[model samples]
Target: MTRPPAENQELYRFSTAERWVHRTSSTLMMVAIVTAAFLYLPMLAELVGRRRLLVTVHEWAGIALPAPLLAGIFFRSLRADLRRLNRFGPQDKGWAWRAMRYGTRAAGAAGKFNAGQKLYAALIAGATLVMMGTGLLMWFPHLSSLTWRTGATFVHDWLALLVGVLVIGHVRMAMKDPEARHGMRTGRVSPAWARREHRLWAEEEAEKQAEAESAEG
Candidate 1:
């Protein structure tokens, strides 16, 4: 494989563990979505004719959806990313307004992850937790009241649809930026790319590098 050239000035964007976690979560989420479709879509359900198997797989997949992210908590880099995702400062709020108004061109001096990315991360994390809880309730009706189970099922179905839509949008956005995808895949991005897309993060990274070099000297 011809390796992509990352110049010396390229910045480290994601750690190997962070990439692994992202891939793992993505794969498992896809599995859960497919199995959910198989179990719920009447025509597809009839075609598949394996309700028991699909149900078991869907339940297990839902339970495992957060495993990769939970495991990532052990890594300092992942923890740092989590913290970044949780934060929404004044810059992030301003960026969000501009992004909504002007699209990608308005992605102002965002940090490692932009306000949109941060919001997506937070929404997906919350959705995952909600899905897990509702899935367990649906999987074991005996654990909850009929009313609660009914509500859980309704919430699970609707949330699954919402998540699917969000994931589609997220993928579409990723497709628009090959360098962004490359960063996720390889854990590095060109400094020029970073500066153009995430100027604040690029500046912070440069400062950190300068400090490290000074200490070494």
Candidate 2:
């Protein structure tokens, strides 16, 4: 492949392992969502004519949703990114509030992930756990009281709907920013884009590069 121009220099953003985790998890989530539609929509379920198979696929997809992240634990880059997502600093709080009020135009200092990205990541992770728990309850109805199973079914359906909406919103946001999508797709992003979008992270990366260069010199 041809290289990016010198004027638009690209720096490594996501590591190979991080990208692998993202790709694997996203594929699994999509499979879960599609199978969920087949199972939940009466017309679709009737048309599909394989309720048992669809249920098994959906259940397994939900169960395996966390597998990518679990495997990613062995990678330092993914671990570091998880740490960044976990911490909610004052800046993140302020950015989140302003972003809510004023949208993406709101000026804010952000790290690798903006407040919105962090919030989405947290919500998706939580929703996945909820999905797994409720799915298990519904899947193994014999293990729980009928009333408990019913409640689990109710929660699982609504949670799946919410997750679908969240996924759509996330995709829309990515579509609006091709540069951001490029970073995730290729594991690199132009320095200019990084500076504009994630100034704090850009500065940190620049310092690290400088230190590495100095050590080599």
Candidate 3:
């Protein structure tokens, strides 16, 4: 028998807490980005005056953002994501090459998470560290040398640029599949959805279930 959308199918790849954390962090980061661009970008500077307000918003937003990520550490989904995102096997390399070619289309041959997604996760992880570090240097520029401070600024700016590109890719990937978004929305995926996108995970779950059944019987 097939499970209905409302059934407890154990089809959720990301737990509720994980979704909450990601959603909170992503939303605030976007807000900060929009506010910062208006205040700091050369073209938009005139329109969004008062740099002080922009800075305050960015500062508080940053303060609010890390809380979710930290909280997510306790969630199993994040641990799985960390492993899945960083595990670059031979198949991942091939998947990534194919994804670059067929980005706007469905991957003709694909794995659970594509190469681009894995690479994007790595980029985000690295960019996140640099972005935080550079922000700290800027926040306390007097402690560093003039040259060091200038370098930090360049690093910070470049990291932002790369993060912007990745965000575009992230959005496109999500938009290409409505089920992906639905998973986020309701914290549930149809069982068929899980099996299609993450067969290995589904298999693991099945094995676990079989073990549990045998022990129970």
Which window of 10 residues has the lowest lDDT sum in candidate 2?
1-10
Worst 10 residues of 1 by lDDT: 1-10
Candidate 1 clash total?
0
lDDT tens per residue, model 3, 4-123: 333366465677887888799789878767876776688987877578888788767755666778888898878777777778766555665565676523443334465677777778
Please give the lDDT score for candidate 1.
0.86
Off by over 4 Å in 2: 1-6
lDDT, model 3, position 127: 77
Runs in model 3 lying further than 4 Å from the true structure: 1-10, 103-112, 213-217
Q: Residue 29 deviation, candidate 2, in Å?
A: 0.6
Candidate 1 per-residue C-alpha lDDT over 15-77 given as tens digits, one digit per residue, 9 for 90 to 100? 999999999999999998888888778877888866788888888888988889889999999
Q: Which residue pairs clash within candidate 2?
A: none
Report lDDT per candidate. Answer: 0.86, 0.86, 0.71
The candidate maximizing TM-score is 1
Provide the clashing-pair count of each candidate structure: 0, 0, 0
- For residues 32-74, write the lDDT of model 2, one tens digit per residue: 9999988878888878867788878888888999999999999
For candidate 3, the C-alpha RMSD (Å) to the true structure equals: 3.5
